[model samples]
Target: MKQPNKEIRVLATVTDYTRFFGLPAPAHPLLTLIDLSLCRHLPRVLTPVVQQLYTVSLKRDLKGLMHYGHQSYDFSEGLLVFVGPGQVFAVSESLDTSNVSGWMLVFHPDLLLKYPLGKKIASYGFFSYELHESLHLSAKEESVLDSLLLSMKGEYEQPIDAFSQDVLISQLEVLLNYANRFYHRQFLTRRTAEHDLLSRFETLLAAYFTQDEGPSLPTVQFFADALHVSPAYLSDMLRTLTGQNTQQHIHQRLIEKAKQLLLTTNLSINETAFRLGFEYPQYFTRLFKSKTGVTPAAFRVSAN
Candidate 1:
């Protein structure tokens, strides 16, 4: 049987999630805004788990690690993070759930179709960012995000109209745009930290291919685990700090290694493929050409 796609299981619907947290049902079947203030505290300890839909969470006055996609993020201050479907996440019960305050906006993908955001949403890379890599809202930024959330809640509470979905979705798109800008700001402001991550990233990539038990291996999870972070977090941090993501970074390094072997050594394309862990030479050729605009052998000949 074919393997299932990688996604977190949010087995609960909007109503289920809300009701579990002690809130009323969602106004719509596909979307809802949860006010943490309205719900009674989760008095019992809970295990971490992942959800199945799109979640745009705005948290405030909370401290805890939200474990998602193999990494635990220390949540401090007001922040936002998006979790795509199928990514496993656990909320650490280290802090009192009663102390947690904020709004959690959960919406299924179905809620987004028929809108421009549905098509352009994939371009929003912040959606893939890890919890540690969550967006930190400045006092002013928090207010802006808060206002948007309130508007959404207000819309839901109003009697349903044809204009309601359009208006709410529009607000969501606007909120996302602002988030994009803020992420760029985060990239700029967190230069030192980003640079550190970049350095570690480089070392990690180099070691993957260099050690005897080295380059022939290491899955995304292995690298993430070794780095003490989540794959999504590492990738998100790279995207925020650099223009590329973790997967792209890996491919870049792989291509560079192939280029070196092609030009510096007499390794045939097939030899290079096996050395680089490609079971098929044609696959390597295709990936190489896609990234560099030339076949591996062609590049090797040109270098000669």
Candidate 2:
């Protein structure tokens, strides 16, 4: 058996990843589709490492946890996980791959150059989601994605031509769009959990503002860290469920508090802003106006 490397292996290219997985050379330098079943020497574990390229994988019947950041996800179903460039994650030591079957599609960032997909790729927030937040695809969704991956692989294995890049890029966009749709489905199907998370977020925000003393403002990262999720994942979830991202949610909460203080308390606008954790009263005034269509003082006067 091949022993796992002690140090993190930074896979910089598709070829590097293929070699590490004990597979043959990639047919294309910039892109490749790996059938996980073809690998004979599967490692029992991998140390935390960063892959400096995009990777989208679908795994099934794996008996181990995939760790990303501080969370671990069970890889025992037909789930899809995405890792953008510079993501650090690891596989569990007790990896049981006896029934493992999946496909990994890896493409270098350079391959996206000169394409519209390159500009919009970052909008696919799943690439930065935690492992536990991976997409759990239904059978029909899995079939749709599987076909797209196979199509991309077919193009990847063919002889390179002038139109090869365009065809491959187009296929990739389709795959991403379908993944986006499936993620929305997942969010809607898991409504209970999402709603629970939103409640926790609201409670946390309330506590932060109610505290008598602390930093002037709570950051999006603060909430994400408290909830044990990435900021991108938290924002994306809020956007899908509440029609707003984390920052917007925070602002909305802040405005509600500000309005209450303005109407019920004798504190001046500056005092109210300070109580709501704003360091600058003017900044608070601008934000209040933007969110409520009136300056803080104007609102306070109108209320009185």
Candidate 3:
């Protein structure tokens, strides 16, 4: 029996994406601002799609499921969701488009050409976050973003001028900066939940290290997956709380375990490396020296 193809679709260009939803072609080849309210006739997407574009979108009173990453969110309040190039998006159920409010700013990488945002945009960690971890906006926060978007839209409607790209890019940078600020605020205000996730992360770290068998080395992705957050989201949250990212925390734990083995166990340094899940002993030795100012052998010698 022939099974249907489940391969994800790719909407390679902004025009293709706009056309797929029966919208007018974009004014610029590389960028577009879409009002979600106009998308009342969106077609069902039988397969998931990956778009090679960057999008910063706001949604309000949206109905039904729009899947991004592994989690689902109820967008009853104003919220922002970002999607970078090559992220998959799926609409599992039809949206009640009549009540959908907000705009989506999408642009190709080329649109950022010769601008600082082209490079600096990579630093915006929220772009890599999952939808369920979206930024919930208060009314005041939403107003600030809306005013900025209005400026961007005014520029977008103007005919192509030498300063059009420059104006657009400037407004975009401001929008992104404000979103960054708001995300930081979100982290601080949601202290209870953030700390809970932190505690869960620590517990998972301890359990992984204390495994009697198969003590596989942990990666940031592993911890993020275990904690049900994106890798970027997990690291950002940890940094906000502890001033150290996930990798640093993992290394701290690993080093503590190394010290414990050196002091209490009869295992050779080589054996210690393997037991700690290091595939190569020299790498472990180098890491120990870097973190603790001594190689594993020297540490064991000095401690005794």
The candidate scoring highest on TM-score is 3
Task: Supply the TM-score for candidate 1.
Answer: 0.80
Q: What lDDT score goes with residue 172 in model 2?
A: 93
The C-alpha TM-scores of every prediction are 0.80, 0.91, 0.92
Ranked candidates, highest lDDT first: 3, 2, 1
Clashing pairs in 1: 7-86, 7-87, 8-86, 8-87, 10-51, 10-52, 48-90, 49-90, 208-215, 209-215
lDDT of 1 at 157: 90
184-208: candidate 2 lDDT, tens digit per residue = 9988899999889988998998887
- The number of clashing residue pairs in model 2 is 0
Judge candidate 1 at residue 187 and give its lDDT. 72
**Which is the winner by TM-score between candidate 1 and candidate 3?**
3
Task: Determine which window of 10 residues in candidate 2 has minimal summed lDDT.
Answer: 1-10
lDDT scores of the candidates, listed in order: 0.74, 0.85, 0.86
Pairs that collide, model 2: none
Best by lDDT: 3
**lDDT, candidate 3, at 67:** 60
| Candidate 3 backbone overlaps, count | 0
What is residue 2's positional error in candidate 3, in angstroms?
Answer: 20
